[model samples]
Every structure is written in C-alpha cells, then in structure tokens.
Target: MSTRLRCLLAASAVALTAACGVGDQAGSNTVTMTVWTSNQAQLDLLNRLADDFSAQHDGADVRIQSVPQADYTTKISVRLAGGDAPDLGWLGAPDAVGMAASGQLADVGPALRNDPEYRFDDFVPAAFTNWRGGDAVYGVPFSTSPFFVIYNKDAFATANLPEPAELAARGDWTWDRLAGLARDLQPSLPRGHFVFQSNEGSVYGPLPVSWPTLDPLLRAHGAGFYDPQTKRCTLDSPAAAEAVGTFHRMAFDDRTAVPPGAQADFYAGNAAMTITQLSRLSQLEGAEFDYGIAPLPGGPGGQPHVTGQAGLVVFEQAPHKELATELLKYLTSEKAVRELAEFYPPARTSVLADAPEIYRDSRLSEQAVKDILVPGITEGHAFQYPRTWPEIKTTAQPVFDQLWSPGADVGSVLGRLCGEVGPLLKQAE
Candidate 1:
C-alpha cells in the first residue's frame, strides 16, 4: 500500500470521518459550500462566519469540514481527483499550482475583478503568485502564517535557562544556539520530557519519504529540496545534509527533540520548545503553564522564516461557482480578514498592519504579536515549493527511513532520496 493511503487508513481507524459537518444547514436551505480544514478552531470560526454568510445569501448554508492534518491534503486531493470537489475549500498554496495545472481549480479572477469595492488589490502580490497565471487567479490566501518557536515557560524556568523571549531580546536567538539550548536543557527536563519538538513530530514516519520533512531546517541552512527554476533535487547538498544531520544528532545523539516514535508534545508541557505556527495556538487554551512565542532561530541562513499559506479556492467542478465566489469574497474582505487575524493571520495588506490589536483578545500578548508573528508574515517568503510537492512527498517516503537510525549516513541516504525523486522532477520539466 502507498504511504499516503496508509496514512488515510491509520487516520480513519482513530479519527473522524472525511466530512465532519459543522452544524445544521441555515434555515434548511442545505449547505451551499463545504470547506475542508485541519484546524478545529478555524472550523468553528469559519462556521460562525459561514452562518452570517448563509443568512445574507438567502440562507444558503456553508459547511466547514474538519479533517485530520496528517491526511488532510491527501484526502482532499483524492476527493478532487475523484470528481467530488467541494464547492469551495481551504487549500495549501504548495498544492495550488499543481491542482490548477491539472484543471482542478476554477479561476476566481473574474468575480474578483468585477467588484471594485472588494479590494482584491489590497492582497499582497506575492500572496497570489502561486495561484495565478496572468490575470487568472486560482486562489486567494486566507492565511499567510509563518513558522515560529513556541516554548514552555515552565520548562525554561525549571531548567534555569533563558526563554525565547529573553534570547530574542538579547539578539541571540538562532538555530545553532537553539541546538545548544536543547542539549543544555536536556538534563534539566523532566524524566520523560525533551527540549524540542519539530512540527507535528512525525518528521520521519512508517514509510518515511523524508524529502520536505526537514525543509524548515533545510531553509535554516540555506538549502532546499530542489531548485525551483531548474526542478532539480538538492537534498544531497552539503548544507542540506548538515541540517538534517543536526536534527538526527539532536534526536539520537543528544536525545533532545522528540524522536520518530515518541509521544511528547509541547502544548502538554512535555517539551521545552517547539518549532510551529499560530493555528496551533488553539492547543494552548487553559494550559497548565505559561508559554512564550518567538521567531524561528536565526542560522547561517539568517533566520529562515517561511510563511505557510492556505488560500480559499473555488473548485472548477463546484456546482455553484458564482455563489462560491461571492462567499469567497465575503469571507476574505478586509473586515473578515481582520476578524480572521485573531487566529489564521491575514494576507490583506490593510489588515496585516493591524494584526497586534486584532489578536489582543487572544492568548498571545501584543509584544509577541508585534515582535514575532507580524514580521514573520510581513517579511518572510511564502514557502517556495515545486508544483510536484505531493508527488515528491509520496515518492520519496520509503527512502527516508534509512537516515533515522543512529550513525546513519546522511549523505548516502539523501543521495538515494535524490535518485528516487529525479524522475518526478524530470516529468515536471
């Protein structure tokens, strides 16, 4: 079985069904659009906004479906490919181009252009690049959230170590120092706890196609999976190997980051620090300890900050494209964007400027919002990924398991990965 399918199977046994419906259809008019997301908070918030949307649009209800993040992109991509596209949905920018090229996405440009008051131009130009071809816009980013560090304040206090906030204040927060801190704090962490956790903590899994699994570290080292323009794999480069090697050393040698088969979580206070983004803030509610948020550590690559993007798109096969477009406009306008900034962050330039205040009611303090969150979104590059990312992730999985073991040859493992993905890249060209 393919790794992606296995993810679906495993998720189904322990998780919710594909479309966990939001609420009752507004006034029984039935759901007009079904949007998919991996975030519970976002699902709830979008459902609330969708309620008002339904009221305004003759009671055309909108359903927000929540899926497990582990298999979300795969499940939704499979659905779209199987002729069962949602009327509208939350799609990752990485997958937008490929889906658009495959004729799976509808060009939303016309509806956007027809309405002058919508302020489509208010969106950052870079936000639309992956989803556009000339005047054709396949998607508009609803979330341009950037990756940052979330540290357990209690862990820092217990270890007698400076927190991320202090490090950022001293201009000493960088990945190298982070590595040292992970090790230095290890002896201080509770018996079963660690010092760091990577995004999702599934860096290398069952089948382990480990390509972009370590991309954040790759970027921190000024390396990437491949050169976008050339469509060539760079996973075997020295910098790339060194970055992955550092994580491996942390996992096996230092025993700091949660390893492949571990069960610790930062939000649960089992970890001292973790590299993650905002949507995860929902996990912090009513937590047992205070937590500090800070920018991703700087590195030789100079604080590699990559904004993870999700855009609202109307699928081509959607039955009510016009209505879907209208709902899209309503949900992404400046007013709605400001409201969404409380969690998802915003792509609208006007709304982006006022993020700190918009999020004042949330758990994050204004300084955290201004110093860490806003800059990561405003100045960070939208994660530049190949249109072939889904293919690359699937095809490269099996080859990555080799490098997870102690003393595993990083260079050789990544070389094999490059070989596995070479055919996929060539086809892209």
Candidate 2:
C-alpha cells in the first residue's frame, strides 16, 4: 500500500470498524459468505439462491448485501483496506483492473480449472479481458451488457418520428439523427420533461461511475478520458470537444436533453430516450408506458459498441477461502447463470445461444434481441480505467461541472480538465 492509501485507511479506521463486521461467522463446518450487489430488487431471488446453496452444502450461510451503485467502489475500497472485505462482490469492468492491480482480488483460476463441470471454457473470451491478469483469472463476468438506446415508443409516435429501430434497419440510425429527434420531440413534451437523459443518471459522477455517463458519447466520437498506452489525458481532443459540444447544445441551446441540474428518468416516461443495457430492462418490465430497444446510434466513430460488465470476484482477504470458492462455483454454474440471464446479459456462450428465445417474450422482442442486444454483447468493448482514476475524479469535479453551462466553451473546458488530471493519469501506478 502507498503512504497516501495507508493514511486514508488510518483516518477511516473508526468508521471502518463500525461498518465492517458482517462477513465472519464462527461455527463447525459453517461459513458466512458475504456478497454485494447493486440491485436490491433481486434480493429475494439472491437470498433464494443462497438458501439453495446452504441446503446443498451442509448449511453454510450466505448473505447478499446491496450497496448503492454510486458508492460501491469507494466503500469496497475502504472495506478491503480495513481487512473487512466481503467474501464475494460484483466489480464493474472499469473498476476491476484497479482493484486487481491493487492486490485486493483473488485468483480463482485453479479452482475453476479443477471443476470440469464448471465449464470455464464456456465463458465468452471477450468478457475476460478486464478480469484476467496474464494466466490468472481474478474474476468472471456475470453481466456483459452492451450499451444501447432505449426509447419511449409513445413519445416517438407523438412526435411523428420513425422508431430508432426503423432508422437502424434503414442504415440511418446515427448520433446526428438522435440529436435531431430529441430536438424535434421536445415541443410535444410538457414542461420539465426532456427528450433525452444521460445514461445511468449522473452526467459526471464522482466515484463509482465516473466515465460510464459520457463513455458512449466520447467513444462514439473516438475520444476517451485517457489513452491506456500513452497514459495521458485525452479529453481535450477535437473529437471529445465535438462530442461534449453536441451534448451542451442539447442541454442548453436546444433545451432538449435533461441538464445537469434537471430531473428526467427514461424509465419513468419523463424522457424520450436513454442509453442503457439489458440489466436495466427489469426496470421497464412493469412500467406503464411502452418502450423500444434499438442499436446504439452510430457516430463519427462508426457506432462504437461499448459494453459495461459486472464480474464476480472472491476477495483475497475473505475469511473462508474454501467456502467462498465453493459459493462462487455454485453461483456461476450453468443453471444459476441461465437464471441470471433472464434479468441481466450473460457472458457464457451456452446461455447466449438460447438467450433470444428467453428474452423474446420479455421486455425485448425477439427481433430486437437478435438484432441489437445479442450482437452488442458479442462485439463490445469494456471500459477500462487506470488505478489512479479515483484520484482524477476527485481533483476534476469542479472542472467537470463547468463544461455543462451554456456559455462554457467545450474545448476550453475539457482542456482545463485534462490540464488538472493529466499529471495524475501520467503518473498512475
């Protein structure tokens, strides 16, 4: 651990002690496995799975905890630093490398290989990129969900705009078209309603989801927060400015997109469209209004297929390594994975082949699933961040806020942002 990280741990000692006693259990042949998830709605389902595991394994206890997605990364970091890490937790692709590089994650590769029925080879090769370090597999992706646009069907009908699916079918689905559609759809909405909302809520998040909101926009324009190879901030590139300027115009110039301070939820029918993944389909399963799924809008980068992943990992410091590995194996077994795929996108090749049939009657139509969702998961890039990314976010909060204003020059704002975080990115690791 670095001197700075040790200082942070020492400063947080009190709170960590109070908040970190949930993972250990003392009994004969009994283990309390702590699991973390972002979706609380699935608590009942997860508990049932845990119950089943306990029944099968001589009553080893399992507990699933849901942490707010916004604070997940930081809280996990604090817990690990305090030696109170959960037995198992879900880590997103962008956050996985940082945690593994920090020596916080465990390698389950050997256990997986020893269990022939586990069929580790059945997992998609692409989904393992962020979870693997050379020959060691630190985690396995449970949700390899691709970012796609979900739109309000009624809003499109009211605005007399062709559905995004139709546009995509005709090879006309593009970011420029999406902006125009948002602008044209605005007049039909009531006050406080917008045509579009940023993906997953925050425009510039502080901790857990810093890049996801802007990732689709930036990558579609061939821009990113930083270059992985060069280890330099690149948000000041012309392509990035163009992408940011486009969003700025929608928020301020056209007043079509929900701004930083405004409220709009795509699932609530307050916005016409949003960029999200299959895992979010459950939110719309019982919504009153009808929704539509479409391929992500193509841009100068030719429809960059970006994906976000949730990989399951056993913490290195977990109290029961043997029991935790057993739980991991059971949770990711073929049957359990198929059940999870009913809600989130699956990374296993076996389930993916039959996924369209399963989702055909769900929120997505069979055609939409095959056309957009399946291809997206199969051919998408996971967003990777450097180990020092949290530091960059902390230092760049003020500059990020300045980029959303009406009078803010997009290039200059991002230039200032890069200037502030560039050194951090350069010196990462």
Candidate 3:
C-alpha cells in the first residue's frame, strides 16, 4: 500500500478501537461530540445548529474544532491514523471514494433507513451518491455549491447583446457567442474596464469559470477524462483538445478576457461578465451598477455542466453516532436548509422547491441550477478524484497560465500537458 493509504488505515484503526457504540455504556445523559470543518461561514452555520441540537437533546454538548482549508485533509488523515481523530469531523466529498475504500467509515444506511424524519431521499442524488461507497452511506451532505455565470445587465443592453436567458433558450448563446460579445464590447470600453477575468489561476473569475463551464463542455463533446469501466485516464481525447482550444481563444487570442493582474477592471466597471458561485452574491450588495445572474451558456452538446464542492461529513467511529446523526438530520431539514440557502445554495430538492424568496432576487441562482447544475447531474458529472487531483492542479495550471500570455500556442502547450499528466492520473489507479 502507498504511504498515504497506510497512514489513513492506521488512523482509522485507532478511531475504530477508541469508540465502541453510539453512547457511553453507562447510558450517560450527556454526550460530547467533536467536529472539524474548513469554511468559517459554514462553521458559523453549524455552530447555530449545534446550539439548536444541544437545546433539543437535553444533555448533549457539541464541541467544534475548525481546521483551516489548506490543512483540513492532511490533519484529518493524521488524526485518523494516530487514533486521535475527532468524533464527527468534516470529510471532503471528493475523497469519499478513496476513504471508503479504506474501510474507516461505519455503514450509515441501515440507521438512516429506519428513521423516517431523516428523509434520505430528499437530497440531490449526486451529493448523496458521492457520500456513499456502495450500499453503505458514510456521510450526509450538508451543503453543495454549483458555479454560475453572472453578467452586467446594463452592459448587455448597452451593447445590444441578447439577455442570456433568451440566448440560452434559442440555443444561440454558445461560448463563442459570449466571447464574440466580449470582443465587440472591448473596443468601446477602456482596456482595464472589460471582462475582469478571462484567465487567472483557479480563483475569482477565470479559474472558477473553466471548472464549471469549460470542463463540462468537454463532457458534452463526448470526452471522458477517466474511463470508469476500464479504470484508466483519457484526458487527451479530441473533445478535451477542442474544449481547451475554445478557452485559449477566448482568453488570449480574441483578447476578450481581462488579465487578473488588472483586478481593478472588474470593480471599476470595465468588465462585463464573470463566472462565480451563488454563495458569492453576498459580496455584490449595493453595487454601483445593475447586474444580473444567468446560467452559463451551453455548447454544441446541448447541455450545461458545473463543478461543485460538497460539505459536511460525520466520522464513522464517532462516539456520539446517534446524536451526531440526529444533528445532521436537523441540518438537512427544510428549515435548516432554507437558512443555509440564504448564503449557499441548498443541496436538497425540497429546499429548492420550498425556498423561493432566497433566490427570488438573484435570478442567477435559479437559472444556473436549471441550466448548469441539474443538467450536469442528469447527463454526467465530471470531477478530479481526490487522490490524483493534485496532478491536475500542478500540471493544468501552467498550461492555463501560458494561455493568457501573448502569442502563446495554446494547443501545443495543452497537448503536451495532457500527454504528461495523463500518465500521472493513471498511476494513481
């Protein structure tokens, strides 16, 4: 076994031995549970839930220890191996497959199946599936966020460009169309005032856009990054080439995208559109200009897709398993989900149906779900598996960075990158 895998197993062994059942054998009224999480905003929300849980359960106390985003995975792995793992800690959904293979988590399906209040079927299938290894469910999804396209309505009207909704319905709003619009508007606006981010490292504008939009386009074009049946990597296919080509042209060749070095362009009203998450809408309050949210446009494949991150998982060996599961159940309820939907999009279909006011003002969230996230789930989803995703982070970034440079050959650069990285992805298997 690999060093990392060995470490994970050792940690799981300790966790499994340290705790026996859900509660203390003496049946103590008070049960203490430990939690680990990354996002401060989410931690706050969970804190509120903890308060509510403690109140309802009479003598239960929940203690939370937050880990910084950068250190979460490493810390959890070490803790699990060393037999010092916290009960009910957060686990990354991307690592679900690999972790489940390590046999660290308790099978939660049987417990949840017997509880009517939990309503396990209400969650988005993708989120639920990602938390389960097979018949067993190791974790319950607390939150899910999908990427969407946000645009300036006034700018679109000024340029006489069609609203994204109309264009999407007409099947006329392709990536090329959006790029062309940016190119057309570029001449009228100041250089720094155009599309704020066309290319950047995985961040605010360009990087987020590529994950949710461009990556999906590859899937629509019939590219398979990994062959599930064969358990192999195939990221160098023609579809991948085409998808990267489009992004290269849009960010560099057409000069439609603003460089990240010019951050002032977006806040200064020079840029027109951006790719962002719905949770980020809070930052746009009291903007000087009128902006609108819309779903990202689709490709020739006739589908839009998005990349997302899943939140909150309970540890299998948690001492207070019953209470933790109860708290988790409450966390996913309509009331709790609606509260979270105020900041982040809820992963439950019921919450989406019940909470109209949350997304009422932000048409972006509504449209993006209908256009991007749902389609991605229904058609096929794509994501970098946790074990080998580091390869993509290291290799694909330089290629993307070069695309923003003047006179760079995006195709040759990407072709070389895929060739080099494909082997690495295969090695992880």
Candidate 4:
C-alpha cells in the first residue's frame, strides 16, 4: 500500500478501537476538551477526529470553537486573559514568542517524551525550533505551509513572458529578474491590474506577501532586523534601508503589484502573478484557469526565502489541559500528519519522507516543505526569517503611503523610515 494509504488505514484502526472502547463503557465519562480552530476545513477535520477521541475515552466530549480569521488571535487572547479560555487553542507560530511569555502554554516536554510515536525529531527543524524554548516543547506543529509565486498562466502567455517552469530550470528567475518582469509587464496591464495583495489595506497585507518571506530577501542582501545574541532589532541598518528602497520601487514605481484593491484580479486572469500562501491551494480546488507555482525568486545572495506560519498551543490554565496536550500529540502523529497531507504537508520530517505525494503538488510548495523537513537540505534556511515582523510593517505604512504618490523623493522617505524604526528595533531588544 502507498504510505498515504497506510496512514489512513492506521488512523481508521485507531478510530475503530476507540469506538469499540466507547461501546464497552456503560456510564463512565472523561473530561470535556475544548479546541479552538481557525479555518473551516481544519474545524471539520478536527470534529471528525473529535468523534474518534470521544469514542475512545468514553464520555470525553471534544467541543470545538470555530473562530473567523479576523478575530482568531484577539478573541483567543481575550478569553485566555479573562480566565475563560478553552483547554486547547490555535496559536500562530510566528506569534508564538509573544504568546509564550503569557505563562499559559504548558511545557509539553513530558508529553513529547512519553509519546515515542509522536517523536520530536520527526518534525521539520524550523517547526521544531519555533515550538521549543528552554528545552521544552510548548506546542505540536500542525499544518506546514510555504510561500510561492502563484502566477496566472494565461496572463504570462498573454504578455509573451517566459514560462515559470523554464525560469526555474534555468536558474535565471532571480528576484531582480522578477522585478524587471514586473516592470516590463506594468505598462501592458490595466490601471489596477498587477499583483495580488492580501490584507494590505487593513494592515501590511498577509504574512505570505510581506514579512517572513521578506526576511530571507533582506538577509540575502546582508541585512537582518534582529541580533539574536544581543536580542536587538536592527531594522534601521543600511541593509534594511536598501530592502525598503527596493520595496518602494516595486509597489509605487514599477506598479507591478497592488495593495488591497482587487484580489480576484489574479483569480480572474487580470493579474499576472501573486506571492501568496500555498494553503490558498484549498481555494483553487475548482479553479478554471491554468496556473503554475514557483519558489519565490532568489536575490543577489543566491537564496530564496519562503514565508511560513506555525501551529496552535494549549494553555496551562485551560480546563482539561492534559486532555488538550494528548489531543495535540495525537493531531501531530504520523497518522494524523498523513491524513492532513491531503490538503497540507505534515510538519514532521518522518511524515514528509513517508508521504511524497504532498510534496509533489507544486514546485514552490515542494521546495518549502523540503527546506523544513530536511536539515541543511536547502539554501533557504541559511537566510534569516522574521518570526514577529508586524512591527516593521507598522513602520513602513506611512513610508509606503508617501512613496506611492507622484514624484515622491524615495531616498528622503527611506531615510525618515530608518530613523523612526531604528529606535523601535533597539527597544525590542
């Protein structure tokens, strides 16, 4: 049987065993474990697993709270601080550092240690590293995703541009080359049709289009926002300034990308390319247009960085927190990993190696999964990736606003941004 098929079989056996145990239990009951999920599909999957979990534990109820993406973090935080938090909840990994300071997350070291089936080493290094602090596992990585340049195949051909496949094969599709392509295609596109921007209007767009991916680019250019040893934010350094300069040109000068206007442009064949999350692949199930995915273009530094987000952590104070931990362990098991891989890649290396179909979907997503699941496996990790980069985006808003206008002095605008953000970085230390 195929690895994926075997994984499904294992999960089915586990579920069946749990159900049989539930049948045996006449009046016994276990604690109710409440789990908060962000996406609908994830909630559905969790609900199904909850049925299995409940059946196995007899009287153990798994209550799920589905939160909209807009309100997920804020709502979870409010509940956590108000002392009414669920036993288990989703915590985006990039935001994990700040959440870790809350004292709510249980040190999952014991849980991981006791469960050999849910081995830590099986995880992608980045996923494992983000979940660990002080030699303890705080959370189990769930869905693993990577950033990619999703292009409208029709648009590319319409402009007579080289195919993304050829670009990747030739190793000539660097960030500089992409910038040039964006510039060249700008005049051909209608006034507002260019690149797709995520939540740029409300904040600084989505994680995929902005910060984390940008981190590798900045690092490739010899710039990093933080000094880990000193724990300082070095965002205002010269390298940072150059990175910002390049961004200003991309957004305003070249008009290759758009901010928060018409997302359907790319989906509708109006825009040529979009730097977006692979998880968005779920949205493409019935896509009518022919599309191709490629890794984010490399820079002069010869490395391409793809952005990613981490999984949910349970708080220590939550009711049935132990059960919460158990659920987390179960969700990240090789069995669950393979099941989830039907839509998303497993966060564990063992699972990745065992299930190759997940990585076979698209070129860019494949590279991203490869980087996380294998050590020194690719050049992507050598470059820095920002964990909490929203602060930088906060500082860039006004700068970008000014630069986007007609005849704005790019150098002066960037100089002001450096001066403003430099102090904030030092304070973040």
Candidate 5:
C-alpha cells in the first residue's frame, strides 16, 4: 500500500473506533466529519451547529476535521478506498457524482422522507440535481451558489467604460460585449493590472475546479461538457470552439485575462472584473476599491446561468449512520438553513422569498441578492459532472494545457479532447 493510503487507514482506524462507540446507549459518543474549509467564520458557524446538535442529543458529540480545498476530494477518496471514511462530509458537485457511482455514499432519501418537518420539498430541484443517481439521492445540497461577474466599478469609471450592471439593465450585456470592454480597458489599467480573472485566477488547481470558470462560457455559447441525453462529449462542437476561442484570445491575443501561471486578484483591485460565486463576497469586505456584482453576460445562445453546488453527504461505511443522518437533517433544517444563508445561498423557497432580509448581513445589497443571486439559483443549471470525471479530467489536462499557448487551435485541441474522453463519458452512461 502507498504511504498516503497507510496514513489514511491509520486515521480511519482511529475515527472508526470513535464512531463505533457513538451508538452505545450508556456512554458518550462522538461523530466525526470532514470539510474542505478552514475559514474561521464558517468553522465557528458549523461548530455552533454541532454544539447545538450535541446538546439536543444525550451523550452525543460532533467533531469536525478541516481539510484544504485543493486536497479535499483526494483525501476523501483515499479514506473511502482505505475503508476509513468519515461519517459525513461536504462533496463538491463532481466528487458527489463520482462517489455515488462508486457506491461509497449512502442514500439519504429514506431519512429525508421520514422527517416530515424537514420539508425536503422546500429545496429547489436544481440544488440536488447533481447529487441524484438512479433512485437514490446521495447527498443534500448545502451550498447552491451561482457564478456572477464581479467588476471593479472604480476601474470601469476610470476606463470610461459602461458599468456591467448598467449594460445588463439595458439588456446589452453579452459575452462579446464583455470581451470587447475587457480589451478596451486593458490599456487603461495600471501596468501590471488585468482586465479579468478567470475563476480563482486560473492557477490550474484541478480540472474539476475549472468548471465554475469554463461552464458559464460554454453554456453561453450553447455548448456544455456533454449532452445529457446522449452522454457524449460536446467540447468539439462549433459552439464550444467559439466559446473557448474567445477566451483564448482574451488570454493570449488581447492580453486582458490573466494567463496560465499568472496571478491578478479581483478583490485586491488588480483586475477589472472576475467570474465567481456569491460566497466570495466576504473577501471584498473592507475593499480598497468599489466593486459591483452582476449576472453573467449573455452569449450567442442567450443568457445561460450556471450554478455551482456542494452537498452534505454521509459515507456508506459510516459506523454511526443513524447519528450522521440525524446530523444532516438538523443541519439542513429550515432554521439552520437560514443561519447558513449568511455564507451559502440557501435553496429553500421560503428563504429565497425572504432573501432581502436574509441577505442583509451579507456585503451585497438587497437589490444585488434579489436581482443576481436569487435568480441565478432559481434559473441556473447545475454544472455538468459525469461519474467518470476524475479519469476524464486526467486525460484532458494536457490538452487544456495546449490551449493556453499563443495562437493555439482551440477547435483542434478541443476535438482531440473529445476524442480522448468520449469513450470514458460513454462508459459512465
């Protein structure tokens, strides 16, 4: 066994032993969970919820282990493969599908159905779409955030460019327009400043991680990762080529977007605009420059909203399945959901209806939440995630690498990508 596997197994042994003792009636029990974020505010909120859950149940406690976002999915996979899985954890959209396919996740449908007060129906269908597999629901979505364009208002003014929100209001905001504006703003920017930052500054952290950045562009051009009905790769399609080609020009030809291995922070006022989710609003607190949030620009296909989701799930191998299920229920309960809305946008219709009030604590204005955040969640399609994503991502990375080069043929690179990953996608079906 690999050293990583051995370490995971050792960690699992300890966690599993603690979990086994959780069900004993006479003794105190602890349920352990793994989560990707170590943000103090988020951690404090989760810890508070865990404390409340513990208080409500006799002799029960909750322990949460923090994992870095980049390494989260790999660590979870290792733990599961090593038979040392945490009872519960957060799963990104792609990881949820992969885990569900491997039978490593427990179906929480029965537990959800049993809790009448939980009002499972209150959750928007799109929130849980990625977590569904056949007759079972592998997870409950906790974060159903949608990608939006955050622009530096001061930068736009200084560049003599129309604000994105104003353009959006006039129904003139389109991907072509955004690209042109980015190019126009490039020369006006400070020497090292950029016009745009692809999602998370394009460090190529992981192929799956790029979906938030790439999916909106693809969907805008009427393309997607694959066709849902046929389960075939669509990256080679004409629309996909056009969409990617536009971005390539922005990165290489126009020099507006931050290129591969280059860095420019939108929050730090280094870029004119960026595409990201609402949760990142916290990063803008006490900002040095004025920023404004707007919905993604429309493309040739018209306006297409793409949402990114993360779900809370129970592992099939969890020793305390019942306890873990209970915790999931409590965490997603209406009151808890409302509290969590401070960070993660809630999918509950009631919460969405009260968005103005619920979002008051956020950095975004009520209008921004209602106009951008709420609509994005309700109308957006979840990012596409195939069960064979890990393998497909590995196969496509080098091909993606080629796209970043100057004057690269995006169509040909994308075609080669489809040729390589198509079989894997088909197998997933």
Candidate 6:
C-alpha cells in the first residue's frame, strides 16, 4: 500500500481503538479540536471560548488547532477518508454539503433540539438551509457575512469623485455608474494604483475563489450558474452576458480593474474599492489612509445582496462526538455568537436587531455599520452551491479563463460554459 494509504489505515486503527474506549477515556479529561481559521483575532476569541468551556467542566480541557483556510477542506477530507478526523472543524457552505452528503459529518440536530437553553429558534432560519441534509443538521452556521464595497476615502477625494455611499444615498449607485466612476478615477490615481479589486485580486484561476468575485456581478444582472430548484444553467442569458461583458470591459478594455496578474489592495490604499466582507476591516486597524464601507452597487436587476456563509461541524469519525457536539453548541450559543460578532456577523435575529450596539466598537462607525453592513447581512442572499460544486468549478475553470482574453466574446464563452457544466449540474440533482 502507498504511504498515504498506510497512514490512513494506521489512523483508522487508532480511530477504531478510540471508538472502543481506548482514547478520551474518563481519566484522560481532555479534548482537542482542529479548526480552520488563521485570523489571530478569530483564533483569540475561539481560544477564549475554549478556556471558558474548560472552566465549566471539572477535570476537562479543550485545545484548538488552527489550520490555514486554503488547505482546510482538503486536509479535513483526507483525514476523514484516512480515518483520522478532528473532533470538530469549521466548514464553508460548499464543503459542508459534500461532507454531509458523504456521511462524514455527524448530525447535530438531536443535540441542538435537546438543548432548550441553546435557543435554536434564535438563529436566522435561512442560515440553516445550507447545513441541512434531509432531516439531519450537519453544521451550525457561525458567520453569515455579506459582501460590500470597501473604498479608500482618500482616493475618492483625490479623484474628486462622489463616494459609493453618496451615490447609494441618491439611488444612483448602479454597476454601470460604479464602472464609470472607476474608469474616471483611474486617471487620477498614482501610477500602479487602480480603481477596483475583486475578492483576492484576480479571477483567472481557482474556481472557488473566482466564483465569489463573479457571483455578485452575475446576480446583479439577473444571472446565476444554475437555478437551485430547476438545476439549469443560466449563464447564457442576456443579463449574464451583459454582466460578464461589463466586467470584461473593465478588466481588459477600460483597464479600470486590476488586471489578471497585477496586485492592488483597497485596505492598503493601492486601489479605490474592493468587494469583500466587513470581517476584512480587521486589516484596516492601522491602515495609513482613510477608508469607508458601502453597500455593493446595484445592477440592472436591482440590489442583489450576496453573503458568504460558514459553519461548525463535528466529524462522524470523531472520537469525542458528544463532546464535539456540545462544543459546537457552546460556540454557537447566544453569548458566544454575540462575542464573535466583533469579527463575524452573527446570524441570530436578536443579535442582528441590536447590531448597532453589538458592533459599537468595530472599526467602522456605528452609523456606517448600520447603514452599509447591517442591511447587507439582513437582506443578502447567501452564495448558492450544489453538491457537485467542487467538480463543476474545476470543469468551468478553463472556460472562465477565456474571459481574460482581450476581445473575448462573453456570450460565447458563457454559453460554452453552460454546455459543459449543464450535465454536471444535472448529475448533482
């Protein structure tokens, strides 16, 4: 057997032994969970929670391991497949679906339902949809962050252009207007600076990363990869074409956006604006330039707010399944959720209602958070995903690559993409 397979077999043996009561025994009195999040602020908060949980239980201790985001899903899958899974971990919407479907995740419903003090009903009903598979709840959403435009106030002033907030207030903040503003501002920026930065600065490769940057634009124009119910690709529609074409013009024709390989960050004042979650405001803690947050510009279809959701799940193969479930509950409880709100926007109705007070000490002003951030979360649609998302994303990568080509036909490229991925989408159904 290969080394990886051997390692998996060895891990499986360990798990089997643990299952038979050789590990996490009464005398052991400790639980260690691996979680995917490298952000120090997030980690610090989680560690504090772990400490609290430990304090409540006599002779019990909890340890948290931080895993890098890029490798988290793959690493978790390998560990699970190899029979060496963490007690619990954070899962993005797409990966959560796959893990739940494969039966790698433990159903957290009974534990949650049995805990009356947990206030399960307090959570936004919509936030739970992604974590549900049949009757089993595989995860508990912790972050329901919506995308917004983070702009450099200095850049807007230097360009003598109205900020996105001003345009939004006047109901003139549309994608077309944003594009025009970006183009107009490009001339005024210092050399090497640009107007807009998509999530993570490029969409040339990595479908998972690229899709977030593209999804909002598509939704803005009444387009989507597929209908969640119909399972039919909609990228070939006129609205999608217009949306893609507009972005194409910005990236290649107008040269307004940071091109495929170029680098610019809104937080660094290297670019005028970027589409991201408010969580990124942590990066601006000591930023040299003045910055402001604004809702995403509306498109032809009107404002289609998009959110990115992430959750906590316990692995089915976990040695301490019961303990992990309790941890998940504790981590998502009202108190924990409120504390996490400093970095992650909470999905709880009560917390969201008091968002202005909850985020009182946030980097963005209370007014800015209330005006731009709160509405986006309350009104945003979570990014859609299918069980076959990972496969479909890989398949569509090359097709999306055509968009980077100068003079590329947006309609043709997208139509071809639909043709290639249509079968995959159907299979996912």
What TM-score against the true fold does each predicted structure earn?
Answer: 0.84, 0.86, 0.76, 0.77, 0.92, 0.90
Q: What is the C-alpha RMSD of each candidate to the true structure, in Å?
A: 6.3, 5.8, 7.3, 7.8, 4.7, 5.3
Residue-wise lDDT of candidate 5 within 1-429, one digit each (tens)?
100111121234345345443223212255667787778898889888887888787747676777777678776777677666678989888888888888889999988977799998998887877888776889998889989999999988987889999999999898899889888889999988899898888635567777778888888888887897798999999999999888888888889989877778988888889998877877897789988888898888889878888889999988687898899999988889998888888888888898899888777788898888889888888976788887888998888778778879999999999999999999888
Q: Give a tens-digit lDDT track for model 1, residues 59-166.
A: 675655555655666866765665555567777776787788788889999889889999888887777657787689998888887788888888788778888879
- The residue-level lDDT of candidate 1 at 393 comes to 70
Model 6 alpha-carbon drift over 4 Å, by segment: 1-29, 39-41
lDDT, each prediction: 0.74, 0.76, 0.59, 0.57, 0.82, 0.79
The number of the candidate with the highest TM-score is 5
Residue 298 in candidate 4 has what lDDT? 64
- TM-score of candidate 1 relative to the true fold: 0.84
* Model 2 spans > 4 angstroms off: 1-24, 36-41, 51-59, 65-78, 207-210, 285-288
Indicate which candidate wins on lDDT: 5
Tens digit per residue, CA lDDT, model 3, 232-333? 555556766676666666666666665435454343356777766665666576677777665555666655555465555556656666766676666667
Cα error of candidate 2 at position 128, Å? 2.5
The window of 10 residues in a row where model 5 has the poorest summed lDDT is 1-10
TM-score of 4: 0.77
Clashing pairs in 2: none
| Model 1 misplacement above 4 A | 1-31, 37-84, 133-135, 206-213
> Deviation in angstroms for 193 in model 5?
1.4
What's the ranking of the predictions by lDDT, best on top?
Answer: 5, 6, 2, 1, 3, 4
lDDT of 4 by residue, 307-390 (tens): 355566777766666777777777777777787766565566666675445557543445544543322222223223233344
